[model samples]
Target: MQSAVYPSLAGRTVFITGGGSGIGASLTRAFARQKANVAFVDIARDASRRLVDEIRQDVGVEPLFLACDLRDVEALKASIDTARERLGNIAVLLNNAANDDRHRLEEVTPALWDERIAINLRPMFFAAQAVVPQMRELGGGSIINFGSICWRIGTPDLSIYATAKAAVHGLSRSLARELGVHGIRVNTLSPGCVMTERQLRLWVTPRKQEIILSNQYLKRLIQPEHIAQFALFLAADDSAVCTAQEITVDAGWA
Candidate 1:
């Protein structure tokens, strides 16, 4: 789908995590098309570099790609600082990094549970912490935290992940009140059954697809671009008054 351009996004610094592949990559391209200064961090160095090259050719502007593990709070903060120094003040932050690897409830060791929550939920807070100063300096900013419908759907085999995603709502609402006076907005962008390459390869079996199709009102798979389009609205001046909301793009499945 062709993406719409936003005058408010042009020249604005936008930071995205896990922006090298899957849905995050779609966001990288969408923001670039809007002429935003897009900077993304990911641990996949090769994929991240390829995405950087692709957008450079496709958009005529190279997005700053920082290869850093989001689990490392210090490294995450450093990468965000670098993006600000290179791109500009980050007025729009997309906390898109997460791992939804399915695990049996019984298979969750203390270490495994900690790792999952760290990757899925911890970065959202620290990244927000690191960027609030930048947003304060810019006078206002938008933060979009990526949540999932797995929790709301009561999908099994993802207890750890579901727990973290549910917590994202709490994070958004709490920060919304605290940051509203600073003109900063926080929102949870919950996606339903998005058919990304990773999900298609790893999880979308025939039976699961059938169940998903039967449940969704649209009877079509939600694409990563759909999420990106919604994100553009939240980042732009159009959603200036919107905050602390769970904006779902799940084809009415949620």
Candidate 2:
């Protein structure tokens, strides 16, 4: 699919989480191709390195890939600081790191629940907090928080994930109101049933695929690049007035 060029994104600084793979990788590539100074943090060192190389080779732009676990708040903060130092004041932030491993409610323990929250939700708030000063200093910026459609459609075996994702919209709304005065836009970008390699490997059996396509208004599967294109609009000045909105790119699913 062809992506629209956002001239405003050129030379802007963008920070993304989990940018080594899946939708995050697409986000990184999209921004980098637009000449944005992209910095991304991910625990997957090998994949991240390869992505940096790939971008450098493909677009002649090498994104800064910081290997840091999002669960460690200090490390996450440090990575953000490093990105700001190396790239510039971040004008866009994509909180795209998340784990949507399905688990039964009866099997969930307190530790397990906290772990899910740490990966799925906690880092988003802290990452936003870390970048607010930069955005404020720049006089404007965009924060695109990753959300999910599972909770909206009441998908089973994802209670913890759904809870965290539901909370993300609340977080976005509250932050949008607080930061709008500073010219910072906060909004949630929820995706539905994207056909990532991980999803195909673990889920997305033939029967499940049929169900997904049948439910969507569009018959095609949702791709990471599809989500990336939406994110590009959100990150750029094109969506300057769009804030506190929960935009879903599910091809009309849910």
Which structure among the candidates has the greatest lDDT?
2
Worst 10 residues of 2 by lDDT: 245-254
Compare the candidates by TM-score and give the number of the best one. 2
In model 1, what are the clashing residue pairs, if there are any? Answer: none
lDDT of 2 by residue, 146-180 (tens): 99999989998999999999999999999999999
TM-scores of all predicted structures: 0.98, 0.98
Clash totals, every prediction: 0, 0
Measured with C-alpha atoms, the lDDT of residue 117 in candidate 1 is: 90
Worst lDDT run of 10 residues, candidate 1, spans: 1-10
lDDT of each: 0.94, 0.95
Q: Where in model 2 is the C-alpha error above 4 Å?
A: none
